[model samples]
Target: MTHTTRTNRGLLRGALTLAGLGLTLTGCTGTGDPAHPITLVVRDAALREIGADCAGATPYNYVHAGTELRFLTAEGTLADSHTLSPGVAVAADDRDYGEATRVPSLCRFTVDGSALTAGTTYTLSFGDRKSQDFTYQPGETAEADPVIALPPLGDPTTEDTD
Candidate 1:
């Protein structure tokens, strides 16, 4: 073949190779919805203030009626908001933490899977407290629920020892 013809054929082959590479990368990242639901847990030691009544109590860390759980995108845009009911007493042994094993309750909530996009990072925030950034892997769910342990409310050393 002529030199010009040979050069054109080489360029075509390179273009095809690049196209195939792009397809392979896309497949690995997954193009479909997540396989499992996204759940987030917001834990705070302040729940112990609800008193020893686990069955009947609604305690707030501050003066607010309830805590606001807000989900934000990587770009810092608000995605959605959920209400975290006032504290309900829970067994300390059930959610015992290191050293201070007197914690009372754990706050839990689930996010709608349809609202989340695969391979995207998100942030869970409660009031001014923010959880670590997490991402839902492509084609699958997060390995575990994102548990945000909020800082203790008021004094940590002043526990009711009665």
Candidate 2:
């Protein structure tokens, strides 16, 4: 890579790292109170909303099926988990209010603990067949967007880490 390109890439990585550290200093996501309830919705490539995981002759229509979500504390403690599908309850768990969260889309995550942003709906997805998770913020909802675009898992240039 050229000197300028390499320098920019390094700077970008450094900025991302600092952003992550800042998020770590923040508290929980302020979502998922056990007393309250949450729900999930599934959509397809066509953005058709469905009541459950897609099945039968054309199962490709449902990508959210079989995806899992784990609500946790700021310290990575498990508050609750959800095997995502259409019309599934968010399974409110009083155990811990979510802080930071990991995503099923391997490398993707929300360091700011904004995955379950309240009163907002988001589409959670990565590559085809690689499911991701999101939440319908309490008191607000939206029609599911098409599968979202995210960075690839692991490093594309490297082989096995071992």
Cα lDDT tens digits for candidate 1, 44-158: 3234532232221234243122456677898899776655443223332233365653554433233344566666777867676775566655332243422232322222245
lDDT of 1 at 62: 33
Model 1 spans > 4 angstroms off: 1-42, 45-65, 87-89, 92-105, 109-113, 128-131, 137-162
> Once model 1 is optimally superposed onto the true structure by TM-score, how far is the C-alpha of residue 143 displaced, in angstroms?
10
Taking all chains together, the TM-score of candidate 2 against the true structure is: 0.25
1-162: candidate 2 lDDT, tens digit per residue? 212344444543443333233223442112322223342221111211221122211243342444454554444444445554322111111123345232111111221223354543344332224344344344321212111222212232453323
**Which lDDT value does model 2 have at 34?**
23
Lowest-scoring 10 consecutive residues by lDDT in candidate 2? 102-111
RMSD of each: 22.4, 16.6
Candidate 1 Cα deviation (angstroms), residue 86: 3.8
Give the clashing pairs for model 1: none
